[model samples]
Target: MAGRIIQVYGLWVWVAFAFFIFVLFNQSHSPLPHSSGKPSTVKERMMRAEKAWETSVTLRHEMANKHPGYPRIPLFPAQTLEAFGKYPYTIWDFFPPVYTCPHDIQRVGRLGDGGKWVCGMSLYENRPALPASKAGKRTKPGTVIYSFGVNGDSSFEAEMLARVPSAEIFAYDYTVASLGPQIAGPDSSRAYFKQVQLDRMDVLDRTPPFMSLQTLMKNNSHTYIDILKIDIEGAEYYSFDSFMDWCDRENAGEMPIGQIMIELHLTDDENLNFNRLLKWWERLEKFGMRPTWLEVNLLAVTLNPNKADPRCVEYVLVNHKDRKNIMRQES
Candidate 1:
């Protein structure tokens, strides 16, 4: 009887140890979405961000230093463990704090697959920062957006342009044969679409109309950008480097871009390309940026069918120190 009791106690201890390990692993590695406000503590995010970066590098490490990082947190208190186990799409049950801002994360369409969200930013920086004017073709201050990728699902761009009527968006996508913006709303004039690669120029165009971010800004007579969103398949990683190089050469220091929303694409062959992404995130940090929001694309699972893939995550970053630069530069 004594031996049997001891055996049972040992088994219980092992089970407890295993459960603890499981929790630790998920919190450390689970790619979680972000809510509003800043992360609670700095040290916590420093650790969480690093660990999170290791396994899956779909992140935007821009100007998120204000709030500490939240790791693969069991954010939803509403859903019980039993509820999560019972459903397939119950992954949304791990709810993070919902952010309300300049405009809420409005879903434009569920067209092909995945949810489309845009015009959504942190309320802290959601004011009408973009200067508007009564005079026609005003030159002093302007709000411009540069979108890099456009498949059929550019509803995110169209919706955002509609929300802020004063802002103009320049979208780039070499894959699309169409050369003009296809916005179907009142603010259609503010949006322009181009069939060019955001990453390359020499091959696509004769003069390369919209070759680089620097050239695009110069051509448009702008020094600072209000918002930049990139989803150019796998080229975002390279274009980001080119953009940084341009900033370093032109501005003498960091380029003041207000916000960035990028979708990172990892090759099916390579899971976590750490060294490259590590350096990329580090460069963004130098420019006073941090990751504000991150969400996984559950819709992507149906497309690829690879359970271990980490390609369809959208990351939002805030550039905290850009307003001054925009005000100081010649536009």
Candidate 2:
């Protein structure tokens, strides 16, 4: 009887061991918990890559908001965040850039301090070769470039026109009567200039006439801007404030700019407080502008010997929402 009981227990133990082995084998062959059980095709790989990119962008945004650079003295007090009760300060290197370009970038201006760092020369280069039959026919209008603060340098404008002669270039600067000799000679017809200051329409006691971006776009009948370059001294704060209000009121949620290359001047003034700077930057980001490139203005450093941090910084930002439309036209 004891032998019979022992044999029954041994048979049960052997059956349990076989079941465990089967379960382990199935687990080893099963898809990972985080992966879909689909064949890896080109489309699937691309989808996975896109998902990874989105995840990385979200992570970087969170990191930027959560961990700011080592705390420093605030640039402005809290009272200046809003203006005229309607416009508010949008908030910045305390604000790290989170945008990147995957295309081949090149410098588009003079080799010295006047040139701009541009991403993807597709707008100026890589035009589909014109067939022999259509070699002379005028192609569609090239990119539209609006540059503010042509203080006396037109190297950028000249090079752009040389590359794409059909391009429409408009420059504005209240300080200068005309563009530099590069574009101001007999060949200046390729570029247009206006002695206007980029400012709010309501500001009073302004000697030179000023116009907001919205007003200029309307007057010029420009529905889109391929590139908008601004180096308006330190007026960006107020200029952007007015522009943001106009955006909120007129264009719904989209900005009409494709790319922005600006030289931001941070002076030791109450207007450029740290909080205000961050708010201004945040506002631009809210409109889908992402900085793909940034460089400390070496000229600013060389010129301003007293300040530890130079007053000027250069930023090249792409408007993700509107760039595709402009890029499609260029292509």
Candidate 3:
């Protein structure tokens, strides 16, 4: 009955809420709270936090209007809010692991160090199923992949090429001169490497040149990236602002990114400024980047004994907004 009502209303929250009121009307006892009328301290705090978020959203719109282009920067809340107890206690508490994947997922790369998970494999498997005798060959029409912070570990990139023969990969790592041994796959020719670090700013003065995502895409003549993988230590904290800025603009072309496989590193700085972290996470969701899968990097926990929470986490996010287009194109 509830399902039928939800389908009819086309808005589950409001429909469910109406059902709740209807059920409460027939109750023997009144649903209203009793006269012990003191306001809830926690509730008051929650309300204030919600108001602050609303104000922040308005400010974000203003910022977007002020700067309408590809390199959109993220704005963080004032530090004064942190001085008061405005943010939540922990990151996990705020971000519950409840994001559900719309399709199946697969793990790519090495088992231990340099691996990550990717979503929407049904579309990725561009070729039809092969017989037992010819199982090795799986050719795809070609998908665009951008990887940041290779760190000489091309296991993931190599594996992705192996799975999708025609896939084109653009890997960046200013620190490393070249890719690892595993990157030398059968179709390794499709993979391109650049000695450039992914940075918030595109500054040529840097040793290897620190370029932003927008600049990188423009340079490569790539309007859309099929898969964007980032494992740049903790640089991801600021790297996404330009991407999100592009999403904010109506003039900017469609963001048909299929998936994002990122390794999030939670350093002491992020832990201290929890609100900023929270805002960053929320902004990703706002841009239709939905977290589908996550795994805590136990290696980080083992290494950082002083930190109570695991510092590194691997996440496989699917872009819900551009998902349909991916399916249609691949189909």
Candidate 4:
């Protein structure tokens, strides 16, 4: 969920955060293992939450002035543990993918083994190929990064192409004409661009309207994609099942994609409701994908909690096989 944890209150590690929260609030944290401290008094909890709220504000100011490029989204007071047992909707945004994992996600930012199993907007998950010139001829990146919303911002794709010359990228969005540098120039990397819309299901056509993941993969002849990154408005749900089905049919045991970093649009579609989407998410563990990072959509949710549930959330899910090497557990 590279869409996750960056100083989410110095959220680099749970041990550091557990110590920070416990020393400040004294409430048990369900996110980490060592946070089994007895729940604090309601008054004490409120005080702690208020302090956290203030810290978040200051952090925001600091990031805005200093590192404008790496912006961090804030969490709402309602979404925090401020009202833990006293409220119902308090947790509408409480989904920590690393802990509850198969169910929901919690905090955001780079959280993984700090090595291979990590997710979030962390660095170097897809390192550049050696000897850039020869690496470009490989025809594909070691990991395939699919960026959806090309809302005139493509620094992520551009950066990855510079680093990982061997990896190929397919950036989509009907709005943009092309993603970054053109694909044919002598200086062009392996990044490719598409203007098609993504949906749950579709058939190949001359028009190439809303296409499915199945069709996308087949058209590219890609049997497997190392990482699937998506941010296509609220259409994430439409193609998730199809992606899994393709994995089921192709690999028989392991899902083809090793990791998925996507911004989920938690829309209230009747057929693909939130609860139903969660059920499908839980099923992912069976295929070896497990949640590792969570970050709420500040623009859609935190900035306006009173409006409605946010449609955008970012998450990073890694495969089961990477647990030992990639999934880092705190000591």
Ranking by TM-score: 2, 3, 1, 4
Count of backbone clashes for each model?
Answer: 8, 13, 0, 22
In lDDT terms, how accurate is model 4? 0.55
Any idea how many clashes model 2 has? Answer: 13
Candidate 1 — which residues are off by over 4 angstroms? 1-141, 179-182, 200-210, 268-272, 325-331
**Candidate 3 lDDT tens digits, 118-144:** 775656666433322264433433578
The alpha-carbon deviation from the true structure for residue 228 of candidate 1, after best TM-score superposition, in angstroms, is 0.7
Q: What is the lDDT of candidate 1?
A: 0.57
Alpha-carbon deviation at 150 in model 4, angstroms: 2.0
Write candidate 1's Cα lDDT for 214-289 as tens digits.
Answer: 7777767877777787777777777778889878887877776876777766653253344355567668867856
Models 1 onward score TM values of: 0.58, 0.68, 0.65, 0.58
Better candidate number, 1 or 2, judged by lDDT: 2
User: Which lDDT tens digits does candidate 4 get at residues 154-272?
Assistant: 55555455545545777777667786432344325567777887877774463547888767877877766666777776767657777767667765656666577777765555555
lDDT per prediction? 0.57, 0.70, 0.68, 0.55
Best by TM-score: 2
* Model 2 regions lying over 4 Å from their true place: 1-92, 127-141, 184-187, 202-207, 327-331
The TM-score obtained by model 2 is 0.68
Count of backbone collisions within predicted model 1: 8
